[model samples]
Target: MTLDPLPLAQALIRCRSVTPADDGALAVLEAALAPLGFACHRLRFGAVENLFAIRGQGAPHLMFAGHTDVVPAGDAGWSVDPFGGEVRDGRLMGRGATDMKGGVAAWVAAVATVLDRRPGLPGMLSLLITGDEEGPAVDGTVKVLGWLAAQDLVPDCCVVGEPTSKVALGDTIKVGRRGSLNAAITVHGTQGHSAYPQRADNPVHRLVRALAALTAEPLDQGTAFFEPSTLQVTSVDVGNPATNVIPPSATARLNIRFNDRHTEASLTALLRDVLAREAPRHTLEVSCSGESFLTRPGPFVAALERAVQAECGLAPKLDTGGGTSDARFIARHCPVAELGAVGATMHQVDESTPVAELRALARLYARVIEEVQG
Candidate 1:
C-alpha cells in the first residue's frame, strides 16, 4: 500500500512543533516509521527532541535528514491557522508545510512505497529528524550526527530535506551552503555637552566611520558555484533621548553571509584588522554560526544529479546559495545535498505546498535512494 503524503503532511503540520518543542511531531513520525520495520530511538539533547530510525543493517546506508521544527508564525495575520494543516483549494497550508514537514512526509511515503515493492532490498535506510533546526540548532543535527558517529552508524551519504527548489519542484539542488558570521562593535567616547563639540568624543561618528569602511567594498567576487560574500549592517544605536548630550558609547551590529573563499578565522581576522585601522579603540564581539562548506562535485554528487534527472526529467542546477541548513552539519560526516519541494512560501503566513509536488518529491527521493544504494 502506498503511503498518502497529504495525510501525513497534515498530521505533521498540525503539531505546532515550533523549535525546541516536539509538540508530538516526533511521536507522529515514530508511529509512522515503526510500522515500516524501523527501529526507532528517541534521542533528547538539551531540551530538543530528535529521532534516529533505521530499517536494515548493512552497507550503502542512506539517511534522510530533516527537522520537524517550524519557525514562529509571528503576529502577522494569516488566512488559515498556522497549525491548522488545512487543505484549501488543493494546497496544504501550515507552518512547516514547505520549509519541511511536506518533504519529510513525502520521503516517508516514498520509503513505504519502496519497501512495499522490494521488502527485502539490500542496504539500510534511516531518518535523522530533529526538533531544533529552527532554534539555536546546537542540539539538533550536529549533536545527532555525533551520536550516530559514535555508534558507527553514520550513513555513507545524507540528503537533507530542506526546501532547495527555487521556482520548480526539481529546478535546483543545494550541494553546499555559505557560512554566516555576526559581530557587534561598541565604540566608546566621553559623554559631554553636545554644544562643546571639542569637550566630547562622539562615538557615533567613529562608529559611522568604521561601518563605512566595512561596507565600502565587496568581500569577494564570488566563486564558481557560490555568490559573492556580503556584509550588511543590521543595527546602529546609541539609545539616548537627551538631545543636548553626547552618549558615552555607540553600538552597532553587523552580519556577514560568506562563501567558501573565506573561513570564519580569516574573516574574523579581516574584520578585526578593519576595526583596528579605522577605530583602534573600539571593542567588538564576533560569533560564527557555521563556516562555509562544499562537498565538491564528486561521485556522490554525480549520483544525486543522475537520480534527480531520472526522476524529475529536468537536470537540476547545483547551487550553494541559501541560508544555512542541516546540510552544514552533515557535510562534516559525509557528502550531503539538499533537495525538496519548491519553497515559494516557506516561512510565510500561508506556507503551503501542492499535493502533486509532494508526490513528485517522494518519487525523486526514492530514485535518489536507488542511485545511492547502487
Candidate 2:
C-alpha cells in the first residue's frame, strides 16, 4: 500500500513518445504491470502501439483507460529537458506529465495499492491504453474496443485519464463530450491575371463567402449538459505565391465540435447546404472523428462523485466542455467518464504536475476503484 506513482510516471515521461512512436513507452508500462499479475497484451496496429492489461474478471469491471502519446514539444523553451522527467520545485516536468502519462501512472500505482489491501478483487480490473491518441486515432481505443468486444472482454464502466481537472486535482469530472467533425473545402476557378478581376472567377472570394455563412449563425444555444456546438475555420490555403496571378483554387479547412442534438450526418448536411448555395462548383470532404455522447447521471456517476468527495474533500463538478478524447470511443461500449489531475498546462511548454498531486490522484483512483466495485 506504499506504492509511489512518481517513479513509474517519470519512467513513462522519459520514453519520448511523441504520437505513433512508442520509443518503449508501452514496454515501460508492461514492465510495471506484469509483476503485479496483469496479463499484458502488446497490440500493434498499423505502426501504432496499444495495450490491454487486465488482472481480474466478472461483473462490475472497472477499466482505467489512457494514452501514452504526447504531443511534440514545440520551440517553446523549457528549463528542463522535455523528456528528462525532472522534479524541480516539487513539479514533475515533461511533455506527458499532466496531459496524461501522470494519470496513467497514478492508476497503475493505485491498482498496486488496492491489490496490497485486497489481493483478489471482487470483479474485473483492466487498463486499455493506446499510443495513437494524439495522432489520427485510427489505430487506438476504437480498434481496441472492437477486439475487446470480439473476445467478450468489454468492461462494465470505464474512466479515461485525460486531465479533466480545471483548478485542482479532482475539481472536475467530464461526463460527456461533444462530437468532432473535420471539413475540407476546395473551391475551384479558372486562373486569370490579377489585373483582370472581372474576367476570372475568383475562388478565394467564393471560399470566404461560404466560410462566412457557415459561421454567421451559432450552431445552437448552449444545450443542457453541454456548451453549444461550435464551428471554426482552422486553415485557408491558395498555394499560389504570386499576388499578380489569380489562384485557380482556394482550399479551407474547418472543424465542428457539436453536441448530442446533432450527429455527423446532420452536421454534414448542414455544411453541404451552405457550400452549395455559396460555392456550387466546390468540392467538400468531411470526416467525423466522433459523434457527441453523454453518460447521464446515474449510479456510475454517483460512485465517481463519492470517490472525489471523500478523497479530495471537494464535490467534483460533472462537466462536458472540452475537446474530444478517447472517451468518445469508449462511451460507445460502456458508461465512460474522464478524470485526472490539473491540466492548466497540458499541451504547453513546461507541462507538469506537482508530485503531491500525482500521489493524491493515485489515492483518488484507489478510492474510485473501491467505490465502484462495492
Task: Return the TM-score for each candidate structure.
Answer: 0.94, 0.91
Worst 10 residues of 1 by lDDT: 365-374
Clashes of each: 0, 0
Candidate 2 — which residues are off by over 4 angstroms? Answer: 189-205, 236-249
lDDT string, candidate 1, 1-374, tens digits: 57989899999999979888889999999999999999999999999999999999788899999999999998877899999999888888889999899999999999988888788778999999999998999998999999999999999889889888888878898999999999999999889999998998999988898899889989999999899999999999999999999999999999999998999899889888888887777898999999899988888888889988888788899999979888888888888999889988988888989988888888888788877877
Question: Per-residue CA lDDT of candidate 2, range 1-374, in tens?
Answer: 55699999999999989999999999999999988889999888898999999987788899999999999998868878999999999999999999899999999999988889888778989999999999999999989999999989999999999999999878999999999899999999889999998889989999999999999999998787998889999999999989799989999999999998999999889988988899988998999988899999999999999999999999899899988899988999999999999999999999989999999999999999999988
Clashing pairs in 1: none
**In candidate 1, how many Å is residue 80 off?**
3.5
How big is the positional error of residue 205 in model 1, measured in Å on the Cα after superposition? 2.6
Q: Which stretches of candidate 1 lie over 4 Å from their true place?
A: 74-76
- Give the clashing residue pairs of candidate 2, or none: none
lDDT of 2 at 122: 86
**How well does candidate 2 score on lDDT at residue 180?**
89
